[model samples]
Target: MATIRERAGRWQAIIKRKGYPQQSKTFDIKKDAEKWARQEERAMDAGTWADQSAAMQTTLAEALVRYEKEVTSGKKGADTERVRITKWKRHKLAQKALGTLKASDFAGYRDARLKDGAAAATVRLELAIISNLFNVARKEWSFEGLANPIEAMRLPTSKNARNRLFLDGEEARLLQALAPAARGEDGRFGDGCANPLLRPLVQLALATAMRRGELLALRWENIRLADRVAHLTDTKNGHSRDVPLSSAAAEVLRALPRAIRGPVFPITPNAVKLGFVRAVERARKRYEAEGGKDERMLSDLHFHDLRHIAVTALAEKLPNIVELAAVSGHQDVRMLRRYYHPKAEDLARKLG
Candidate 1:
């Protein structure tokens, strides 16, 4: 049953049904209110109104908040994702109802974000999280018929893959710069306390090709000192693999005093980023201070470039990609190739 009345110069429609909850709405005119009531009542009678009811109470911000608490909190990269979700919560789209989102809304967001100097990769990742939310809502939260708006939108093209490798003498310069910074006058890593970790950290990264996250996550229990293998319980690809440590890499680990039982290197990811950036700046400054020209100084180097150097070196020595994958944790041969950037001089030697 539905009833319409004029209340404060507006038509108010109150609908009641046997199996459904009571619905109420206000319209400028009685006819419009009556039309809405008729359509809703018909849809309810035919049992085709779940789409309207399922996501009516929940907004994208509310869903994402719940997701972060329930799902993203359990992830290894939870802090990073929590930050991204915080940004998402500030967007206008987040306030919209979960089922009310359209692809065109996101197209506008993508354009706006790009105009504001956000990278294509950053926007794509943001959209991916949104898509993940829709999938979770549909499959887990019972919001059926809700389509992922990302599927309707086209994503920005990703630029060329980074194949940055250490230039000649840059590796030595990085170590030289880090050597003094990792320690104080008393000689230590954290606030000049004890056991400076940067030199060993950089060396192990080159020798083992381990990611910054993997290195930071490493525990003493995971490292088999006798076998010289680091057991990774959680990798980026969601699979575990045993990484064999070279003698040099093993030496670095063996030298470090195990002060904490949880993580071998208890450092934040952002600390490593800031540390690397500072190291590069110091390295470049030192190089230019001497006879070295400004152009000759390593200004474009990144810490991850060490992984590329390690992979290419392994590719030169190792017989096959399978062997290289064991060291680098790359699941695909093509992805492994991206890291296997052999020096032109090394290739030129083969040509002769």
Candidate 2:
């Protein structure tokens, strides 16, 4: 049996049936309430009814908090996921009940984000977190009737692949800018960064093609200079691989005084990002002072581009795609191709 009543300007539909718990829902109109009650009663009669009270009551923000504690905390990119979760919590959509969220809501969100100048990749990642959360809720949080809104959405196609490479004299200028600031004999301070690790960090990044997180998380005990191998127990893809270090990379490690057993870089990711940005600013200023007019030189350089630069250089030396993939820690050959951007002249030389 079903009951319909007006409660505070809204019609409430209540259903009671044998072998089932009480079910209720509120609608703006009496017709809607009656329609909902009839549907639920029929579904219950057919033994197809599932409780959706949790989904109806829980907000996206609440789900995100639980997801962060249980799922995001265990991820290697937990810090990054935390940032994403924080962003999600700030949005107006996060206040909506989980059961009320539909594919249209996220389609509008995607369009709105793109209009607001958010990158396709950023929006995709944000949506991915929600999608996974929905799946987790359905499987473990007793929201089996809740359909994943994001699964029905057409995700934004990402076209953000960067081919930015270092120009001649740019690397030298960058290294000089990252150099340790030392007092001269005349008591004048030279242009350089206060952090001594910046130069070697850039050098090693150019040599190894490792991700920034991998480099920052690097430990002293993992480096075997004799074998020219750096064992990475933790990586982005959750797979461990021993990265083969080049002579240049080994020299950088040898130059630094080895710690007993701690972080090799001993720098936070935020610190590295700020230091790199400052270093680039300094380098650009230095280049301008040296009568260089090339605006493109050292412009729009990112820390992650160093990995691309290293992979591209390694491709010339290694020649074998599989060998390059192993060194670069790429699980997919297609993804490895994204990093390997050889000059047309270089490829022509190899062809001849």
Candidate 3:
């Protein structure tokens, strides 16, 4: 049954069905309301009209909770999904009913996110998560004929490959400042609370080009000391990679006292970050004291930049391009190019 009501100087068509709950939509005129009622009544008679308003009552937050439990766990990079879900829950979209969400609503959400000063890459990632949720709802969860509103919305262009790398002499100075053992009044190795684990971690990162999570997750069993390779099973690319060890890298690894527990780098991820922060602070203080103009040299250098340093070094040192790709575990040269820069001598030789 359908009924028309006037509320706040506008006409609304309300439809009540037996199996499903009631649904209502506002219209400008009585004829439009009557027309909609007739169309809905016919669709209901044919058993084809889905109660979209009832479906929409399921909020985005509720869908996110279901998605985290049902879908995200089975996928690659589930941790990333967890983070994305958290972000989505914080957004205005989370409060809206999933069924009532239109293409225009999503467009408003996108625009709002941009206005809030979110980077394009961040917005794109969030949108991808939302899009994936709708896809799951439609195909897997049996939300039949429910169109994805986000598909119709335009996305902002993401900035790729920001040139974050270590400048010359910065790496050496940073390493030098990271004391193996801080001196105390008694001048003992264990006197001060300097992290003995950090030096080897830095060297390994500069040698292997491994991500922070991969390095932190490294186990003693994965290390092939004789072959001079570190086997990385859990990687961003979802492929196991074997990172060859240089002599300097090997020496650092050999010097590290073995941990009795699970992880080779047994420090907490937070501890690792805190240690790096402290090291950077110390390095910055030293640089300023020395009257260097390049205060920005080590300021912008993240621990991840060590991987860039490793890749850049390999590209500059290795004669064969294919050989470099194999060792670095880069499937293509596209990403490898960003890290690689020819030495001044190599450039002079090429000119000659």
Candidate 4:
């Protein structure tokens, strides 16, 4: 049976049914209430009515906290989820309860987020986090009949093309700036001094094209200097991969003192980011001092861009660009293409 009640100047329909927890929803019209109740009844009879209240009772923030602690914390690459959770906490979707969130609510949130200058990629990521949370709720947390609202929603196309890469001269200049900073006097830089890891980090990124997380998680045992290969224990696709080390890359690894404890790159992810920031600052200052335009020298250079440089170099060296895709650990050729660039000689030959 379903009854209509007036509360908070809104018409709320309260339904009582077997196996269905008591459910209520506010509607503007009595007919709408009747229509929804009939639909719900059919769904309930078919054993398809997901307990919306069970899902809705948990707020997005609360769900994320639980997911982070119980689910993400157990994973090997859990830091990425932690970063996503931080972003979600600041998003409007985090304020809403999962049960009360209709498809329209998500649509509005998506639209509003776009209006507020969030990129399609960012919105898509937030949606993914939400969807994953609900999935965990249903499968792990015993929240029955909880439909993922995001399933009914379509996210905009993500702009994920790699537009940033180091040009020939750019890499040389960056290395020249980073080398002295990385190998400072006495092999250890003083506090407030330049990062001691910048050159080696850049070299590894350019040679291997490994993701930042993958690089940071590398262990000393994984680096086989004698074998000339670095065994990556796990990658983004949840597979173990072996990346061959270039001569220069091997030299960089040999130069590094073994970590006393865990990861080869023992610094926290935040520390890596901070080190990158400091390196960028130093590079910018040097560029300006040498009479270069501040904007031109610093234009669109990110730590991740070094991976693009590696992939591009490898693609140009081989006749089949697809061969390098395996080395770069890209599952798809389409993804590999984003980082591939034609060699200048090849371009010249084509022009001729």
The C-alpha TM-scores of every prediction are: 0.78, 0.86, 0.74, 0.78
The candidate scoring highest on TM-score is: 2
lDDT of 3 at 23: 68
Give the best candidate by lDDT.
2
> Per-residue lDDT for 235-280 in model 2, tens only?
9888989999988999999999799799999887777888999999
The digit string of per-residue lDDT tens for model 3 on 1-352 reads 6999998888999988787567688888988998988897898889887656534667899999999999888865567668779878987878988887788877787788889998787788888888888888888876766778888888888877555777788887777766666666786654222887887788788887777778887887888788898887876677888888787777777888765446778776667667787787777777888897875777866676677777777777785667787677777777676656667897799889
Write down the lDDT that model 1 would get.
0.82
Clashing pairs in 2: none
Instruction: Kindly give the stretch of ten consecutive residues in candidate 4 with the minimal lDDT sum.
Output: 189-198
How does candidate 3 fare on TM-score? Answer: 0.74
Encode model 4's per-residue lDDT on 1-352: one tens digit a residue: 6888777766888889876678788888878887888788888888777766657678888888999999889876577669878887777777888776777777887898899998798788777877888888989888887778888987878776656865445666776667643445787764333656766887888877788878987888777888899888888788888888878878888888876446777666776666766766666677788888647565667777777767777776654656786688887788776556667997799889
The lDDT for every candidate, in the order shown, is: 0.82, 0.90, 0.77, 0.76
Which whole-number lDDT from 0 to 100 does residue 196 have in model 1? 52
Q: Against the true structure, candidate 2 has what lDDT?
A: 0.90
User: Candidates ranked by TM-score, best first?
Assistant: 2, 1, 4, 3
Provide the RMSD of all predictions against the true structure, rounded to 1 decimal: 4.8, 4.1, 5.3, 4.9
Of the candidates numbered 2 and 4, which has the greater lDDT value?
2
Model 4 alpha-carbon drift over 4 Å, by segment: 3-14, 17-47, 108-119, 167-169, 176-194, 259-261, 294-296, 320-323, 332-352
lDDT of each residue in 86-194, candidate 1, tens digit only: 9999998999997778999999999999999887987898888888888888888888667889989999877776677777888888887777334546644532212
